[model samples]
Target: MAYFVTPEELVTSNGVDVRELGTGEQWYEAQPD
Candidate 1:
């Protein structure tokens, strides 16, 4: 399965202004960005 979200939602939700996040075994953000 996969997860999806709109750019506006990402920015509004957590202030993430990125377009895409690619595949990876693990990902982490030490603190909110």
Candidate 2:
């Protein structure tokens, strides 16, 4: 599994702006079991 920090500004998978996260916040994608 891998994770990355979100940029200063980002767009969600659903194409929505997520400005709540702080810079360098860890972001992850959901994985199937």
Candidate 3:
């Protein structure tokens, strides 16, 4: 499966910015902006 953050994780606006976890071999589910 492709890697990505969940829809719930993307909708929040008041939390600390953090890293997206993954290894380099995986494809992304989205363009990651």
Candidate 4:
């Protein structure tokens, strides 16, 4: 199933300065403050 996220959740989960990886697949990189 496809996953959906809200803007608030994304910001909260990943913070405001999050990066994404796409090596063979897509994923979010959690950056520490």
Candidate 5:
């Protein structure tokens, strides 16, 4: 079975920054933070 994970859950489980994990995946990266 397949399931989805929320960004918060991902961070809690891996203890990683969402932005760091999404280095090459964040489409909105081009826009200034």
Candidate 6:
């Protein structure tokens, strides 16, 4: 299944602050096992 993440979440996950980049929805695909 596919997954979705917001720009803020993505940035935060990478150790960056969400406020620095703003927020937006983005789609991602699952990797093959």
The model with the greater TM-score, 4 or 6, is: 6
Query: Candidates' TM-scores?
Result: 0.21, 0.31, 0.19, 0.23, 0.22, 0.25
Error of 4 at 23 (Å): 13
Q: Give me the runs in candidate 1 sitting further than 4 Å from their true place.
A: 11-33
Q: lDDT by residue for model 1 over 1-33, one digit each (tens)?
A: 233345344332454333444422222232234
As for lDDT, the candidate ahead, 4 or 5, is 5
Question: What's model 5's lDDT at 6?
Answer: 57
Colliding pairs, model 1: none
Better TM-score candidate (2, 4): 2
Candidate 6 lDDT tens digits, 1-33: 323345445433345543454432321322232
Question: What residue pairs clash in candidate 6, if any at all?
Answer: none
lDDT of 5 by residue, 1-33 (tens): 222235444332345555565643252333343
Q: Once superposed on the true structure, which residue ranges of model 6 sit more than 4 Å away at CA?
A: 1-11, 24-33
Model 2 per-residue lDDT tens digits across residues 1-33: 333325654655555454555422333334232
Clashing pairs in 5: none
Model 3 misplaced regions, further than 4 Å:
1-3, 11-33
Mark the 10 consecutive residues where model 1 has the least summed lDDT: 23-32
Q: Tell me, what's the RMSD of every candidate? A: 8.7, 5.9, 9.4, 9.2, 9.0, 6.5
lDDT of 4 at 6: 50
Q: On a 0 to 1 TM-score scale, where does candidate 5 land against the true structure?
A: 0.22
The lDDT ranking, best first, is 2, 5, 6, 3, 1, 4
Question: Clashes in each model (backbone N, CA, C under 3 Å)?
Answer: 0, 0, 0, 0, 0, 0
lDDT scores of the candidates, listed in order: 0.34, 0.44, 0.35, 0.32, 0.41, 0.39
Quality of model 1 by C-alpha lDDT: 0.34
